[model samples]
Target: MGREFSHIARRCERAVVTAYRELRDGGRGDLQAFGACTTLYRIHHPEASMTEARRLVAEWIDHHVVRGASSPTDGCDCA
Candidate 1:
């Protein structure tokens, strides 16, 4: 999975994906990793609502991890 994240264009997306994969690989459960990722997003985007944070995190995880997709992702204006 080393090269899986190299192509991400957004800082926020890259951070979230790297952190989520690391957390999961380190024995964290799905919910735990998801919560940590949500918090990570909030740290970069404090103005984001909890709803928005969770939505984006889940979308990113599903897109990059679960779906193994390399396509562009949508989120905050952090690109």
Candidate 2:
């Protein structure tokens, strides 16, 4: 988990990705976990619209979990 999330500079991004991965591994379906992650993001950033939360969450999952890339992601400024 540390190795996977260490590259993320923002707390929100790291948190969303970690929650998504854990949810997926803990027998939750893909969409279910995704929804949970989106909700998690919105919880942290109420100013974000549902669409924004969904996009950021999806990007985080793809970058950290699916692609395993550490490239900086585009999203919230919270750290």
Candidate 3:
């Protein structure tokens, strides 16, 4: 059952990623992109509230932004 749950979780993550990419490519702002992703998330999780979806998407984006900003190449001057 755990393996099955893991697979479902991975699929959900991929869906969120795809939503984010589409929103970004469409030139949406951060808040708009997050709102769109939250809507996408809710489609997969009907029981989830808008507030909960927003929180989850915000945290996910914040985590990736922090990780990317802290990467060695982010501000390096290497040629």
Candidate 4:
């Protein structure tokens, strides 16, 4: 059961990474994509907690806003 939960968490993490990459690549940064992934977990595994989802979203926002890491094509080179 732990392994299954870990696998789910890993998949969620990957979704975050992919979304970030898309945003960095000059693509849309809407919350829908992020929400879709989280929603999937919620719908598929009702027993799973959303602690990880919340953490990922918070981290994603922090990375894009507070950290000033603009999209890759945003003309800023300051990682």
Which numbered prediction scores highest in TM-score against the true structure? Answer: 1
Q: How well is each residue in 1-79 modelled by candidate 2, as lDDT tens digits?
A: 3345677898889889889888888999999999999999999999999999998999888888888888898778787
- Sort every candidate by TM-score, greatest first: 1, 2, 3, 4
Candidate 3: segments with Cα more than 4 A from true spot: 1-9, 69-79
Instruction: Score every model by TM-score.
Output: 0.93, 0.90, 0.61, 0.34
Q: Cα lDDT for residue 66, model 1?
A: 91
Q: Which stretches of candidate 1 lie over 4 Å from their true place?
A: 1-3
How far out, in Å, is residue 70 in model 1? 0.3
Reference-based lDDT, each prediction: 0.90, 0.87, 0.56, 0.46
The total number of steric clashes, by the backbone 3 Å criterion, in model 2 comes to 0
Please give the range of 10 consecutive residues that has the lowest summed lDDT in model 4.
1-10
**Separate clash counts for every candidate:** 0, 0, 0, 0
Q: Measured by TM-score, how close is model 1 to the native structure?
A: 0.93
What tens-digit string does per-residue lDDT give for candidate 4 at 1-79?
Answer: 0111122224444354455445645655556655654565455445556875555455644554446444322211122
Q: In model 2, state the lDDT of residue 53.
A: 92
Tens digits of per-residue lDDT, candidate 3, 1-79, equal 0111122234444466556756777888877877887887788777877887777666545544424322122211112
Poorest 10 consecutive residues by lDDT, candidate 1: 1-10
State in Å the error of residue 68, model 2.
0.7
